[model samples]
Target: MGVMNELINRQNVETLAQVLGEAAPGSSWGHVAGAAAELDGLSLRARTDRISTALLADIRLMPEPGFPTAARTFRTALGSAGFTGWIIWPVSETAVTLALETGAGPDPAGDFDDCLALLAELTPRLTGEFAIRRLLDRDLERSLRVIQGWTGHPDEHVRRLASEGTRPYLPWAVRVPGIVLAPEATIPLLDALYRDPSDYVRRSVANHLNDVARNAPALVVATAERWLAAPDGNTAPVVRHGLRTLIKNAHPGALLLLGFVPASLAVTGPRLDRKSVALPGELAFDFEISNTGAADARLAVDYVVHYMKANGTTSAKVFKIGALTLAAGETRSVTKRHAFRQMTTRVHHAGVHALELQINGIRHGHTEFQVQV
Candidate 1:
């Protein structure tokens, strides 16, 4: 089974049912078991929703009246499941989502605080990011305060949440308007996690900074410069990954920071294996470069393909080929193959496409190819 399948399988729901049974013996495990049986016929998302719905009903059957009490009850039940660390994350995620969807009352702020605290203890398990995003929509300032405090938490998971939860362009989660509009607010939390002792937390911090870099390159460049000046072993990787987007975009400041100097290099013989190819085919090409300059040069070589769209327009997609250093009077040859496979996120249209080689962010050579259906 795939990872997603393994995560929300029949067995997981059964385990959850057992835990709930252990938590509140008076509750109906038969109902929970019946719900788990229905999951095998549904998709992953449907399974999650069904499980949450089933768990909520079971919790209601317990003595608890409010969501806060129910969330605590679920967490306590989860502890008895014999699953250590993050293996039980999905269960916690489902419990938290159930709390958020069905538990909010007149005191939303108070309810949100309770949920946030519960998430901290149970480990958000990848669900806290979106949950926090929703909370941000309800109360930006208050939610930010809660998230900011998480940055200093003793638990690395909570500290990671401080950055991950506030990412402006977090994938699969609703965007936080405040952070999207003014990302500078998140700088303090990013700074706190910049040199985090845990690699997991550092990765989240780096990704958060990368999201910030998309909107504010100058800010990221400045931050990278500062971090690099007094860098430790762990901090170095964070800065490098944080600047990945800018570096891939060939931002001048990013290249300079990474020691890749922009220099006029000679590119020759961009030879294609064939001038034309059909959809779902491969395009192979080779190119050579020479360092005509008098000094050693570090170069980032990338290729941009201007794909033809259905509307008779073209969209450019950049692909990184290779990065190398050439001594003065040295030459090198590189070859690459690009597959025009159909992608769900992209539609392929038959038309003449333009390919170009970029050296140190400068377009150096150009070629054309035809893609047919």
Candidate 2:
């Protein structure tokens, strides 16, 4: 089995049940074990859902009301699981999440404050990113206040949650409509974390900014420019990564900001090692660049391969080879080999393939080769 499948198997669930039973002597393990066994045939996500449902059924059996007491009870039970690192953390967090979800309902028997507090405690352990989404929808202003406070928290994880949880375009998480409609609302939080001491936090901040850049490119560019104006050794990575998508799209403003300008450049000797190839073959090529301009040229050298699809149409995929600076009359040579090995993600088709060189977003020379089954 794959690593993920092994991690969430029945054995892990039983281990969780055992830990919970140990944590709370009176807690019933038989029911938890029985429910977990039912998850044997389910897929990863389905198993998680089944486990949550099973835990909810068992929590209902406990005498304590849903809110603070029962939730706290579960959190306390997790303590006995020992610090097994991230492997088992999600399993524990899933149980806790079910408890919080059950307790925060309209007829919740638990205290709202207690649920929020438990979420805060769980933030560092397994990330309250998913749980916080519901809270944001319930009360945007209030959730923003809570998240803003977390930005200054001592834990780097909590601080990252503050930015990540509020991302307008957080992947696998529901969109925060308020942030989508008014991205400026997230800027204050981003500002607090743009130069965060933790690379972990700054990376999240960069992704958040990049998400914003999708709908508001100018805003992100302006923010990057401002940050770059007073370049800090730490913030440079964030800025560079945050602008990656834009740079790939060949945004004029982004290229200018990064100093990748167009120059009088020429590419020659675009040759493929094989004029025809089959599956499990390799395509190798070499090319040389000539800087015919008077001034020095900074070039972002890349290549694109136009792969033929089953429908006989073609799609161009770009790959970065290297970068260089060439003084007047300087010449440099680069070579690369790409594998035509079958991939689960891409199916290879037989047809004429086109190859080209791209410098500073401009395509220079072209060559063609053929591929067979």
The pairs that clash in candidate 2 are: 67-110
TM-score of 1: 0.88
Which one is best on TM-score?
Answer: 1
lDDT of 1 by residue, 87-111 (tens): 3444454544544665355665567
Off by over 4 Å in 1: 1-6, 29-31, 82-108, 124-127
Sliding window of 10 residues with minimal summed lDDT for model 2: 83-92
Residue 294 accuracy (lDDT) in model 2? 97
Error of 1 at 101 (Å): 7.1
State the displacement of the C-alpha of residue 296, model 1, in Å, after optimal TM-score superposition.
Answer: 1.6
**What is the C-alpha lDDT profile of model 2 across 190-300, one tens digit per residue?**
888888889999999999988888788889889889888876788878987888777766778877887789888778967889899898898899999999999999887
User: What C-alpha lDDT does candidate 1 achieve relative to the native structure?
Assistant: 0.76
The best candidate by lDDT is 1
Taking all chains together, the TM-score of candidate 2 against the true structure is: 0.83
